[model samples]
Target: MNGSMTDTKPDTKPHSPVLIGLAVMLVAFNLRPAITSVGPLLTGIVAETGLSATGAAALTTLPVLCLGLGGALGPAAIRRLGVDAGILAGIAAVLVGLLLRGFGGLPALFAGAAVAGLGIGLAGVLLPALVKRDFSRQAGRATGLYTMALCVGAGAGTGLTVPFEHALGQGWAAALALWSLPALVAVFAWAPFAKARPAAAASVARRPAPSLWREPLAWQVAGFMGLQSSLAYIQFGWLPAVLQGRGLDALDAGYLAAVAAIAQAPGALLLPTAAARARDQRGWIVGGLAAMVAAFLTLAFGPEILTVPAAIVLGFASGGCFGLGLTVIVLRARDAAGAGALSAMAQGFGYALASLGPFGFGLAHQATGGWGLPALLFSAIAVAGAICGLGAGRAQQVGQAARGP
Candidate 1:
C-alpha cells in the first residue's frame, strides 16, 4: 500500500488539457440529475404508487445503497476496464437507468434508480483519480470545477423537472426521462477518451494496492464523508417533501431545493482553493459543519419567510463541506493511486453509511407523524460529521504512519 501510494507515472499521449477538462465537467454534470430529479416529484410518485412513507424512503434509499455497492466495486472495475472505459460504462448505465425510470411503474423506477446509482458510484470514484492524474499541478482548481458542475447539474434537475412536466404536459415520468438526454450527451463526449486509453488506465492496472480499512486517517475521512453525505442526500431526497409539508406547493418546494443546489456553486468553487492554501483544513471543516447544522435547522423549523435565506446558507455551508470532503481525498494522498484508493474507501464506505440517513429520516417521520424527530436526526448527523472532520482535517497523508518501519 505504501509503495503504491508513492508511485508516479507520466501519460504517454498528450491531449489538450482544455478538452479533457471540458469532458470531465460534462461527465460530472450527469452524475446528480437523476437523483435530484426524484425529490421534487416524490409526492406525486407516492400518490400514484400508493407507497407509504417507509416505502417512499426505500425508493430513495435504494439508489444510494447501489452507489455504495458501485463504489466498492470501482477499483476492480477500473482495473478491468481502465479509467476512461470505466467512466464510459458508468455513464451508459446512467443513460439506461434514466430511460428505465421513465417507463412508469414501481418496478421500473426502483430498477432504474439502482442501475443509475451503480453508474454514479463507478464514475464518482474514478473522477477524483482522473483529476489527480491529469491535473496534478492544479488539482484543487480542477476539483472545484468538477464540484461546480455537479452543483449546477443538481440545480437543473431540482429546479427544472416540474417546469418540464408542466410545459410538456407529460407528467412526472416524462420529466424524469428528459434528464436522460444529458446522460446521452455525456456518453459521446467521454467515448473518445475511452478509445484513446490514457496512461492512467495502465498505471492503475499495474499497481497492487492494499485496502484502507485499517488506516485510522482513512476511517476519519470516510466517517466525515459519510456523515456529511447523509445530510446532503437527505436534502436531495426529502427537502422538497419537507417544504411541501410546511404548506408550500410542489413548484415552490422544488424551486427552494433548486435554490439550495445552485447556491452550492460558489462555495464549491471557492472553498477547495481556500482549504488547499490554508495550514490545515480542520477550521474550515469545523466551521462548515457548524454552519450547515444551523442552516438546516432554520430551513426546517424556522419562520416561513426565512426559508429561502436558510436554504441559501445551507447550500453554501453544505457545498463547502462537500468541496472540502473531496479536496481532502486528493490532498491527503501521496499520488494518484493513493487518491483512487482513498476515494474508493471514503466514498464506498461513506455512501453506504450515508444510505441510512434518508431511511432513518422516513422512519422517524412515520413513527412520530411529524418532522421534529427527523429534524433531531439531521442535527445529530451534523454534529457527528463535525467531530469526524476534526480528525480528518489534520494534515497527514493516509497510510503514512500505518506503514511498517
Candidate 2:
C-alpha cells in the first residue's frame, strides 16, 4: 500500500519533464474557455433565445455546478486511470461538450456547458496532485505554469468571443464552437504524455485512501476555495452586464472584464511561487482578501471613475487567493495521495458551494433591481473568505492538524 501510494515517480529512463509540463499547460489552457466564452456573448444569446436574465445566468451557474460534480468524481477517475489518462479523458469530454454547445440551440448549449464543466472539474481536481507527485521539488512553479495558462485561456475567451462572433458572422453559436478547436489541440498534445507512462507506474499511481472529510483544516480549505470561486464566477457571468449598466457598451464591457481576467495571470503565476517559500501563507491570504473587500466597495458605491482600477484590484486579490488556495492543498498534504484527497475535498465541495454565486447574484440583482445588494453581499463574502483562509493558510499539514495531540 505504501509503495503504491508513494511510488508515482517518473520512469528511470530519461523522459522530458518539459514535454509533460507543456502537455499539462495545454490541457490547463482548455479548462476555462468553454465557460468564459459564453459570458461576453450572453447578451446576444438572451436576445436571440429570449431567455430570461436568470436563465442566461444558468449558462455560467450550471457549468460550475457540473464542475463541482466532476471534481467530486476526479479521485475515482485518477484511481482508475493514471493522472495522464484521467486528464486526457477530461480534455476529450470538454471538446465534445464544446461541439454540442456550439451546434445546438438553448437546450444543447446548457447541456454542453454542464458536460464541459464536468470535464474541467475532473481534470481540475487532479492537477494539484499531479504537480505534487511529478514536480514535488518545484510544485509551486508547475502550479504557476498551469494556473497562468488557465488565466490566459480565460482572458482569451472573454476578450475574443465577441470578436469571433463578429468575424465569423455566424452569431454566438459559432463563437462558442470555436473553443472546441483548442480542446482538440490539447487532446492531441496530451496523448503522447499519457501514453509514455510505464505500465508499472499505473499500478503504483493509485492514491492511498485518506479520510479527509473528517479534517477541519480540509473543510476550511474547501470554504476558502468555494468563496473565492463564487466571486470569480460572479464576475465571469455578470461583469459585462454590470459594466453595461454603468454605461459601457458590450464590447467595452467585455474588454474590461478581459482586463480583469488577464490581470489574474500575474497573480496566479506569482502568488503560488511566493507562498510555497513562506513559512505560513496567512499574511498573503489576509492581504488578498483586504484587496477584494476594498475593490468591492469601490465597485458598489465609489465613483464611476474608479471602476476600472477596482476591477483590476479585485482581479489581483481574487487571483492571489485562488492560487494560494491551491497551494495550501499541496502544502497541507504529506504525499500525492494526500494531495489528491485534499484536492477532492477542496475543489469538489468548494465548487459545489461556488455554483450558487452567479445564480444567487443574478436572483438578488433581479430582486433588488440593482447591483448594490449583491456588491455588499460579495464584500461580506470576502470577509468570510479571509476567515476561512486564515485557518486554511496555517503552516501545518492537514494530517498533522487533524491528529492533534
Candidate 3:
C-alpha cells in the first residue's frame, strides 16, 4: 500500500459504520488488559521476577509512559499506514507484546509492556477519531459504549489475573500471560474491516504533527484527564495489595478490589451522558472530587471494615469523572482535527501522570507504617483533580475556529 491520505477518500471505503465501530471497540477492549491485569497479581510477579521495589513499580509505570508515547506518535503512524491498516498493526503489536511480557521473564516483561503500550497508544488515538468519523451524530452515546467497554475490560483483566494465578498454583507468570488471549480474539474480530479497506498504491511523506503545547484549553483538558487517570491507575496497580495488607486473604482482597473496579463500567457508561446533557458540569466535577476525598478519608480514618464500600464509591467516581473528562475533550474541540489533537494532548499527559500513581502509592506505603499518609496525600491529588476538572468542564471552544484557506 503506497499513497497519501490526502490523495484518497475514506468515504469510498467499503466498510460500514457498524463494522468500523465494532472493530474499534474490540481493539479498545484489548488495549488495557495487559497493562492493567498485572496489578492484581503484582505480589506474585515481584516474587517470581525477583524485581526490586522500583522494578515492581515499573511494570505499571513503563506501560503508562508508553501509552503516552503511543498517543503522541499515533497520528504520524496513521499518516504512514492510513487509519484502518494502522489499527490492524497496533492490534497485532499488542498481541505479540502481551505474549512477550507474559512468557519471557523480566526484561521481556518490560519489552512486552512497552510494546503493548505502543499498541494501546496507537489504538487510543485512532479510536477517538474513528468515533468522530463514523459516529458523528452519536458521539455521546458512542463514547458511553466505548468507555463502558473500557471499564469492563479493565475490571475483567484485574479480576482474572489473580484467579488465573491461583488456578494452576503457578504464580503470576502464567496468569499474566493469559491476557494475550483477548488480543488474539480482537485481532480476529477486527479482521473484516482491515480486509475491506484498500490500501493506497503510493506512499507519501508524513507531515509534521501540529503543535498543541501552546494552547491553554489543551493544558486544562490534559490536566483534568491526567489527574483522574492518576487515581484510576492507582487502583489498577495497587488497590488489591492495599486491601490485602489490611488483612483480607488473597481471594477476598481480589474480589473486594474487583468490587471497587466493577462500578467503573457503569459510571463510565453513564456519567458523560449526564454531563453532556448539562450546560455547566462544574458541580459534577466538585462532587466527584468530594466523593473521592470521602473515599480516601474512609481508607485513612474510617474503620477498616468499610474498605469494600469505600472502594466501590471511589471506583465509581473515578470512572465517572474520567468519562466526563473525556467528554470535555470532545465537546471543547472546534473540529475533528482539533478533537484529535486534544485527545493526544490529554492522553499523553494523562497516562504519564497516571504512571506516577502506582509508584507513589507503593513508595509512600512502604515508607510509612500504614496506608493513612498515602491516602491523605492522594486526597490532595484528588482535590487537584476536582479543581482542574471544574475548570476544564466549563463551556468553551478549543480556540477561534480557522477560516478556510
Return the top candidate by TM-score.
1
TM-score on alpha carbons, each prediction? 0.95, 0.95, 0.89
Report the alpha-carbon TM-score of model 2 versus the true structure: 0.95
- Residue-level lDDT tens digits of model 1 in 123-147: 9888877777777767778888888
- Which structure is stronger by TM-score: 2 or 3? 2
lDDT tens digits by residue: candidate 3, 322-372: 777777777776545566667778887777787787778778877885887
Clashing pairs in 3: 2-201, 2-202, 2-203, 3-202, 3-203
- Tens-place lDDT digits, model 2, residues 1-405: 001123434553434678778888899889998888888988888899999978976777999999899999877876788777888888899999999987759989998998999999988998887787777787777787788888888888898999998899988888899999989999999887677664423653654757888889889999998898888888788888888877888999899888888878888888888988998888998898888778766765679889889888877776777788888888888877788888988999999999988888888888898988888777777788889989988888877885662
Q: By lDDT, who's the top model here? A: 1
Question: Would you give me the overall lDDT of model 3?
Answer: 0.72
